[model samples]
Target: MATMQECPRSPEAKLGMRVEDLWDIQEAQLSPTEKLNACFESIPVSAFPLPSSNQEVEIKSDATLSEAVKILAHHNILSAPVVNVDAPEDASWIDRYIGIVEFAGIVVWILHQSEPASPKSPSTPTSATAIAAAANGNTFALELEALGLGSASTTSGNFFEDLTSSELYKNTKVRDISGTFRWAPFLALERSNSFLTMLLLLSKYKMKSVPVVDLGAGRIDNIITQAAVIHMVAECAGLQWFENWGTKKLSDVGLPLVSPKQIIKVYEDEPVLQAFKVMRKEKVGGVPVIKSGSNTPVGNISLRDVQFLLTAPEIYHDYRAITVKDFMTAVSSYLEKNKTAFSMSCEFVTCKMDCTVKELIQLLDREKIHRVYVVDNNGDLEGLISLRDIISRLVDEPRGYFGDFFDGVLPLPANSRV
Candidate 1:
C-alpha cells in the first residue's frame, strides 16, 4: 500500500518551484514507470478534449428517478451531474450541483424498491432449460448506449411498472436518495490541476469519474473518466516508457490484485436480484457469473448491464424470480439476434496469467471494457483486473507532489461507491 509522503520545507520550497521542475531534472534517474508518470504530470487538464457543452445532459435535482434514467439512456451516459435547480446563477459550482447520480446507484435503488417484506426464495428452478424457455420471447440485447455505441430498442419497459411500489421510481426525486450509500461526494478538478492529481483520484481514491470544472467560466468543461485515462495510456503504445512497462507480464505487475478466494462472484442459480445486491454491497462495478456448482465463469454481469433488464420487457416480468442464468441467457440471445446493437461488452474479456500488460491494455481498450478476468488453462476464473487496478500499478504519487491540494474536499465515506 502507498502512503502520502511528507516533504519538509526547504529554502527552495519558498521559491514557488512546482514539483514538475524537480521531476524534469530527475527524469533521467527515474524508472520506466516513473518516466511515464512524469510525462503525464507535465500535461494539464486543459489538454483533454472538451465536451460539446456542459449543459448537454444536465439533470434537475427535482427530476424523478425514471426521468433521470431516460435522460442518461438518451445521452448514452452511465451517469450525469445532478444540479440544484434553485441555486442562484451566481452560486459556485459546488453549490450548483448536488452529486453525480450513476446507473449503479440507481440499480441499487431498484433492488431496494423490489425488496420483499418477507424474504423467501422463488420456487422457479434456475436450471438452463427453465432459463432458456424464459428468454425465448425476449428481444432486448445488452443495450450499451451508455457508451454512445448505439441506440437500444425503446421497448415498453416494465421495470418501474412491474414493481409493486411503482411510485418509488416514478415519484421519488433524485435528491431524495442523497443519503444512500452509493451517493458519491461531488468532487471536481480545476483545469490547471496536474494530470497526476487526476490519476491519483481516479485510481487510488477509487473515483469512477472525476468532473473537470472550469472555475473561471464556472462550467463543467469536461468529465475525465477512468475509461478516458485507459484510452490515453493505450495511445502511448509505441512510446519507449509505456513499451518498457507494458512488456512486463501481468504476474510481474502484481495484477488481479486479489486471490481466487478473494474474488466476489455470484452463481448462475442465484436470483438476478441477488447478483445486483452483491455488487451493491461489494462496491464493485461488476462481477463474473459462475456456473452453478462450479467455479467456471459462464458470463459477466455489471451495474451498467441494468439497461437490458430495465428496458427489456420479458426480463423484468418477474423481477424477484429472474435468475442470473436467465439474465445471461437473455443477454446472449438478444445480442445474437440484434448483433449490431450489441456492443463488444456482451462478451467478457479473459486472459491467462502470462498475458502481458500491453496485451491486457489492448483487450480493455479494444473492447471498451472497464475490467478483464484472468482465467486458468481450463478457463476457470482465477482473479480479475479492472481499469482502476491497471492504472494504480502504473504510477506512484510522489512525495509532496500535491501539497494539501485536496485538503478542503468533502470526506468520502469508507464504503462510498461512484
Candidate 2:
C-alpha cells in the first residue's frame, strides 16, 4: 500500500493510458506486408522532395554536361528529369517531360570520354550541309551517353575520345542527350497508385526514383524512392521483426537473395572503367574491389566516388590511363587535403559473413551508405546487400516477420538514415 502511494514516470510515460492503448491497437496488426503498405500510403508523396514553384532542381535539356553535373552536386541530387525547352509552344506539359539524367549516366559519359578515340574510319572532308548532318548524328550518340543508355564494350579501347576532345562534355547541350522520351521513355507512376504498385514498379524497373505523375492535375508532382520503402517498413513493422531478421548472419542473408549472375565485382589493378562498366551493365551503384585471382575484398568503389571527377576535371583528363587505384588514390588525396576543412571520411564499409544482418543495417545507417559488401571467413568477397534488396525482401517475404521476439539487443538504437 505504501509503495503504490507514489511512482515516478518518465516524460514519454507521462502520456495517458488511452495513448498506450492506441499504440497497442496499431501494433496488433499481424499481416506485416499489409501493415507496411498501409503505413506507406499514410505518408504523403510530399514526404520526399517535390518540385517547387521555382523548379530550380529541374535540368534544362539545353544545359551543358558540366552544368548538369554541377546542378546535381550542388543540390545533392542523384538525378533530375530533363525538361525540354524547345517543346512546341502549344505542346502539352507532359510532352515536355523528357528522360532523366542520373549520376550513373554521368559515369557513362566519363568512361566514354576516357576511352581513346577509336581510329575514325578514313573519311574525306564534305560540304557544309553534309558536315552539319554528320555533326547532328555525332550529337545523337553523345546524347545517348547523357541518358545513360549505352552498352559496355568488349573491345579494349576507349570509345569517348572524340566526344571529349571536341569539348562536348563542357559544351554539349543536355537536350541532345535527353534522347527521346519515346526511346528511353519517361517511366512514371501516378500519385494515386498503391504502395505495392510503386514498390513493384521500382523493383521491376530497377529505378532509384520514379516520377509520380498526377495526370488529372497535369503535373509531375513528386517522386517515390527505395529509401522511402525501407523507411516505411522499418517504422511500421514491429521492432521485434527487425530484431529477428537482424539476428540471422549476413552469409545466410546475402547468398540466398543474390543470384550468381547478379554478383558484380572488380579487381584492384583493373582499370577503373571496368568497375564502371560493371556498375552500368548491372545497374548497381557500387562494386567491391578485390585482389586478382581471389575474392578477398581490398576496397570498394561507388557512384559517389565517381562524382569527384566533376570537381577535379584534371584527374579525368588522364581518365584512360588511370587504373582504379589511381582514381581511389586521387579521391583519398583530395579528401585528405580537405579533411581539415570538411567533416568527411573516405573509408569504405565492409562486413564479415559472420556478422548479423542487424549489424549490417546498423552500419548502413551509421555510414549513410546504400550497400555493404559481405566477406568470407578469409576476408574474401561473398555477397552484398542494398536498400533495394531489403525493401524487396520485405515485400516478397512478409511472412518472415512472423516469429518469436528476439532477446538480443541492438548496439545502438535504430536511426532510419536510409
Candidate 3:
C-alpha cells in the first residue's frame, strides 16, 4: 500500500498518472501499492459542496409590518426578504430578491409609529389612550402594512410599476462606521481614562469599533477592546503570576494577529453566488467590495446579506448577474439625498484614535455590528475592528491540561540542535 508520502498533490494529475509513474517517483517511496487506490478514491467533488443558507422564516417585502412581525416572532427569524413582484424585463419575475427587513428595523419603526403626535401635558393621563394620542397620528399596524406593500397597492394593483417609476431603491442613512473618520487625538489621562472609561464611551455611542492611532507616528497602531483588556488581566494573574513566569507581551498570551493577506476583497459587480461560495469555502463572515476603479472600500457584503437573499430564491436567480453596484448604497448618495442607506436609518458611529480597546468592545456589543472601521481625521480609511480579533484576545486556555509536561525538559546539547 502507498504510504502517506506517496499521496499525490493534485487529484487531476493522480487520475492521469499511471501506477508505474507513481512507483517510479522517489519522493513517494511507496513500499506497498494497495494504498494507492484509497488515496485516489478520496479526490471526488463530493469532498466540497457550496455553502447554503440555514432554513429560516421568509416574508414578502409587500407584507404588512404587523404580518412580518407576527411571522418573524412565530418562527424566531430575525429578518425577512422584501420582494418586488414586478421586476424589470431582464429580471426574472420569480427572482424577487429585495433587501432584508430585520427585527431591529421593525422595532425601530414600531417605536416611531407608536409615538404620540403631541407632547402630553402634566394633566394628561398616562393610560393607553393618552399614549396613542401622542403618536403623531401614525398607526403602527397601518404604517407597517403601508411600508410592507410599497406604494403600488394604494394607487392600483400594479405595485411594481409604481415602485419602478419612483426609484424602487431608496437611499437611507444606515449606520456605517466607515463614515466617522478621525485622526489620532490625545485623550487626556485627566479625563479619568482607563480601559473601563473607553468601554463606556463605546457602549453609550453604540459604535461597532474605535481605532487607536499613535499621535506621534501619524498612523494607526493597535486596537484595544474590553475583551482584550479583560483577558490580559486574567492571563497575567492566572498564568504568569502563578504558573508560567517568563511569558511577556499580550501577544504571547493572545491569538496571533491576522495579517491583511487574510482578508479577501470582491468586486461589487460579482454575482452573490460567487461571493457566497468564497465565503463558505473560506469560513469567513464578511468580505469588502471595492468599486471598479477605486481601491477604497465601497461597501461590505456579509452573511446577513446572503440570508436576506435566500429568503427569495426567485430574486436570487434573477439577480445572479447583478453586481454590487446594482444594490450598493453610495456614501455621497447617503449624505445628499436625506435618504437612509438602502432606505434604512441605521445608526452610524465612529471614534477617534487613542481610544482604548475596552471602549471599542463596548461599542461592538451595543451597536451589534460585526466589524468597525478606524479612520483618519479627514475620514480616510485606517484599519478595522473585527469580532474575531476581540475573541482571540479574550479566550483563555484551560489550565493543567499539559501539567508538568514541560517541567525540567532536557535542554538540547549546544552542538546537537536539530
Candidate 4:
C-alpha cells in the first residue's frame, strides 16, 4: 500500500502512445512505449512463452460441480476449459468443447437453486448471519414477524444447507450450468492472433482466460490469463517505457473506472451468501468488504473463495454461523497456518488512493491476487481495482488499435458490456 501524495493529473494527458508513430518511426528513434506497442502488435499468440508445468488443467464436460471443484482446487486454478465428453474424433474445435467452467459459475448455480420454487417448497437457506439467525430457534424470524420486516411467505426457514452437500451441487454437471453466468464466453484465441488481441480479450471483453486452440491440431496449447499478462508487465520493470507509465500514481492513470458508490461491497455483519449473490448478479470476480457503518475495508472476498466450502468443508466448524467477517477470519488464519498459495489476495488486500501502478503490479504478482482495494488516509475504502483495470489502461481503444481482431468470431450478444 505504499503510495504517493495526492496530485492533479493534466486533463489532456494522453491515454496511450500514438499507434501511427509505431508504424512510421525508425526502430532506433522510437520511444519505448511506441516500440513496445509495435512489438506487441507484431507478436502472435504462438510466440508467447509456454505455460508453467502445473498449468493448463482442463475439466471434462461430464464432471459434476463437486468433481470440477476438486479438479480446480487440486490444481489451484480459477477456471478450466471443458472438453466435449461425447465429441466425435473429427469434430471442429468449437464442437470439441462445451464451454469453460468457472468458480463463479458454480456459485451462480448454487444461488439459483436456493430460489424458492413455490410457497410449499422449503425456504431458501442462507449462510453467515442468516444461518446464525435460523440457528437461534427462529427467534429472529418471530421478531421479524412481529416487526413486519420479514414474513414466512418470503425466505422463511433454512433454505439452503451446506453448499457442498446440497442436492443440486452433487447432481449438476459443468454442462448443465453453461447458462448460469451472463459472461461465460467459450472463445478461443488462435495461434496467429496478435498479443494486443489477447490483452483486449482479457481486459475489454472480460475473458478470465482465453483458450489457445490449434485448429489444425484441434488441441489447446495454453490458456492466456490476466495473471500471465501481469507477470509479463512485471518482467518489464527496468524498461524505460514501463517505468514511464508505471511510475505514474494511480490518480494519473484513473482506473477502477467506477466511483465509490458504484462499487458492489458487502458489510462484515451481512450473510456471506449475500456476498456471493451480489457478485454473481453484478458479474464481478470479487467483492470488497466494508466495516459496518464505516467506509474502511476489512477484507476482500472473491467468487473463487468458495473453493473452501467446495473442497474443504472442515475449515469452518459451523458453516451455518459463518458471517462474511467469520468467513474472512477463518480463511485468513487457514491460509497463514498452511501457507497455501491459493489466492492469498482474498484475505485483506488494500492500497492507498495514490499508489503507483507499478507498485500495484508488483503487489498483485507477489500476492497472487486479481483485485485490490484503494482506501483513503483513514484506510476507508475508495475503490477496488483489478488486473483488468491495469491492462485496460495500456491502450486507448482496443477495437480501433487492433484491426479486425474479432473477425470470423461469433458476434457478441447485444446486452454485452461495451
lDDT of candidates 1 onward, in order: 0.69, 0.56, 0.38, 0.67
Where model 3 places Cα greater than 4 Å from the true spot, the runs are 1-256, 312-320, 329-353, 375-383, 400-418
Worst 10 residues of 4 by lDDT: 4-13
> Which stretches of model 4 miss by more than 4 angstroms?
1-36, 116-163, 182-184, 340-343, 398-418
Candidate 4 structure quality by residue, lDDT tens digits, 1-418: 0111122121111112222233345388765445665656766777666665535677888888889988887777777778888999988888887777777667665455433434564344332225324433333333323322222122211322344665446766777666445433467888998777787778877777778889898878888888888876775554446677899999888776767898988899877767776777687878888899988788888888876656656666555456788778877777777666564555477888778999999999888888888888888777878999898887544336756746666554442321
Local distance difference test, candidate 3? 0.38
Writing each residue's lDDT as its tens digit, candidate 2 over 5-32 gives: 1331322122212222333355554564
What TM-score would each prediction reach against the true structure?
Answer: 0.78, 0.67, 0.33, 0.78
Error of 4 at 302 (Å): 1.1
lDDT of model 1 at position 281: 73
Report the number of backbone clashes for model 4: 5
Candidate 4 achieves a global lDDT of 0.67
The sequence of per-residue lDDT tens digits that candidate 3 reaches over residues 283-341 is 55567775666555666666545323322223323332345554344322332454332
- Please report the TM-score between candidate 1 and the true structure: 0.78
Candidate 2 overall lDDT versus native? 0.56
Residue 255, candidate 4: C-alpha displacement in angstroms: 3.1
Ranking of candidates on lDDT, top first: 1, 4, 2, 3
- Report the alpha-carbon TM-score of model 2 versus the true structure: 0.67
RMSD of 2: 11.0
Question: How high is the lDDT of residue 13 in model 2?
Answer: 23
